[model samples]
Target: MSRSLSIIWLFGLISGFNIMITGNTLNYWLAKENIALQTIGLLSLITLPYSINFLFAPIFDSLRIKYLDKIFGHRLSWICLTSIALVFFVYILSFLNPFDNLLLFASISLIISFFSSMQDTILSAFRTEIVNKESLGFASGIYIFGYRFGMLIANSGAIYLSIYLTFNEIYKIFAILIFVYLILLIVGVKYFNSFNVIEEKTYSSHTSSSHLHLSLYHSNTSLCHSRTSLCHSRGGGNPVNNINFIKRYYNHLGKSLSSYILKIFLDSRLRGNDIGKSENDLSLLSFIVLILIFLILYRLPDNFINVMINPFLLHLNYDAFEIASVGKFWGVMGAIVGGLIGGFIMKKKNILDSILLFGIIHALAHILFIILKIYGKNSTLLFITIGAESITGGMTMTAYIAFISSLCQGKFRATQYSFFSSMMGISRSIFPIISGYIVVNFGWQNFFLFTTIITIPSLLVLLKIKNKLQQ
Candidate 1:
């Protein structure tokens, strides 16, 4: 790879890592702080602001960051600002104890989440600008790997550290780590300047709407000619004059509209060879139900596990350290490995097939939890169950990520992906709340069974989209 591409990838890694660290660590820490389980679900509300970025992406496309785009450039400046803000916010959070000041902690977390979301938007747009279409899948893999590693550090490493240190200390250490990431991001901003600038200018000019304006002007000319033709046909001129006018009108209208529409569609290219012959080919509306089913069902087992696992551990008389250790070592590591493997497989295999297979494996993995529930909290069983769940979950996640990436067109990649990812966040956020209720009312075993049943709809959706996915 070129030096600029390498820098872009590194920035992606840093951003991914930063995002995951908080996501994985916060839950465990929140529970340890004695917050209600229901409130933990509400913590996902912090990400709600990110949903607006999708709505405003077109504005980002049109607006420049003033001299910042000329100074540090567009993508880099936004990324740097957001990264610094995120680091500052996280550091501030290190000082507040959630127990004494729940509002303060919640406020800081929301701020961090907002900055993190903006960072993600800029970083994703930067990646789309720098990386070639062919490299997107591999780039995504690297990102997920880095992200999962961060989770490992936060979930597993932090838990291990907590055995010897206080939660406040761990927060400070990770805050320092976030600062280190900020430094790396600054370096990336400098390194990527030359190559990314060229691509950005090229893409920007090509996707500009000047051509569309010209096309509309030509269409207006055609409409004028058509009016003239009608006047001639009403005995104002010779028949030949009428025919010539009508011919010119129809020809100009056809050429202008066709060219303009074609340009609009072709502006956002897809992954494969065939470009924009039909917009419907790229539309996911037909599969909205499929996507909904996939989201709800694929995540059900994990959601149930998330809700009940901590309480179940508490009930089994396992301490926070043990649960954190197992979750970090087995769960985090397995997810990273599975994500890497899934990304690799997607590079060669059909995405739909991969999703189906992983979904099936994920559904089957729930059986391990049932076994664990029956056998009761042996460390070995806990590790084994977590490992199985994480691996399958990772696989499912990787496939889903790749599938969503494939669905996005070049122009709207960031916005479209953000929308889809936010949908995922919504499901993830809501599932836990429902799972909490289920664990309280239905109990753990029945919850797992319900999760298994939910997987059926996702499987059917996979079948529905199988052929299109292969294409």
Candidate 2:
């Protein structure tokens, strides 16, 4: 694997840890603030970036700071920059008292989520360059394992550390950790890019005239006066031209997009290469439509529960430490097990088939929570509910990610995947907001039953495309 792929895996850990710090570790803190349940449920709206990063994904995919990229390479430079932004925004969170300034806290949360989602977009694109589509299941598994471990640590780790440190102090500690990570990551990326620069320079020197001519044709430009732009970039005379060059590149590619996108999305079919089609889906348009339906409904149950789980547990008289340890920490452990199982299952089975199988388990896993709500707080029951939900959730996520990876456009991997993921996040974010209302009016048991009921539409969509979801 390339250094870039390795970096993405480790970044996954950071992403998991940081993202969960809000969703799980600080779950009780946010709930305990006495804010209205409706406002707390709408917290998923802060994560809107996860669903909509495609709007700006092209910027990350193409544009870069010329000066900074020279030192850190294109992707790494953005990663580092975004990571810094993430640290700043997250640190700002420590200073905001959610109890007194809830709206400000929510605003800060939105900004942090934007940066975190951007980091994820860059990392996914970086990984696409190195990891094979067929291997993405295993790669996602490995990534999820590390990600969930960080979640485990953050969930349990932060709570345990609270015995000695205040919540503000804990936030500061996390900020410091991010800063340290940024420094080390910069050093590593510098070496990696430097090595590539050397390798490319040596190789370019020995290229035959024919190969060099082919490179010019492939670069889609004629004004290459020197060999540097052939491999490095298209800043022939001035760095400013690079922006125009990228614009032309994408505009031209957009014109040349597959009939699938043009016909399905733009209302006209022009002959062109199939840009985002995978091995199984001959009609990428239909495949993606079906996938979108599935994506929108895949995790409705979980998102509904997630909005109220902490408050529900608190209602049952569980302390923050208990929620962190049993709910967050042990749940992560279950996810790790599920990640392993999910990886193996997707490796052996078709991605969509795996999704169907695990989606069922994922939907059914809610029964455990319903059980917990019914039986009240038995430690055994608590562990069982958390464990079952975590395992199925992890498995479904692995399969869903693998399926989405298959849909990412070859050239526009970041933008395309962002759109798909954002489609899914639309459901995730909206349903959670409604969860507050549901639990408040209809009660937890009825809300959970509704979650289970909503899972049917996604399964119906999955069935519509079952034949095409094959290996």
Best by TM-score: 2
Steric overlap count per candidate: 0, 1
* Model 2 regions more than 4 Å off: 1-9, 125-142, 191-241, 245-290, 343-353, 406-416, 467-471
lDDT of 1 by residue, 1-471 (tens): 555555655655566566654565676677677676567666656555565554434333334455666666655666667767776787888888888988889888878877776676656666655555566556655655565555566666777787788778887887788778767766665764555554356444423321100000011111111000001111112344434545553454356533433333354443343344443533533444455556556666675566556556665666666777786667777887788777676555666677788888888888877777787778888888888888888898877765655554445343344445666766665556666566667776887787777888877877866544346
TM-score of 1: 0.71
lDDT of 1 at 462: 70
Worst-scoring 10-residue span by lDDT in model 2: 209-218
Compute each candidate's TM-score over C-alphas: 0.71, 0.76
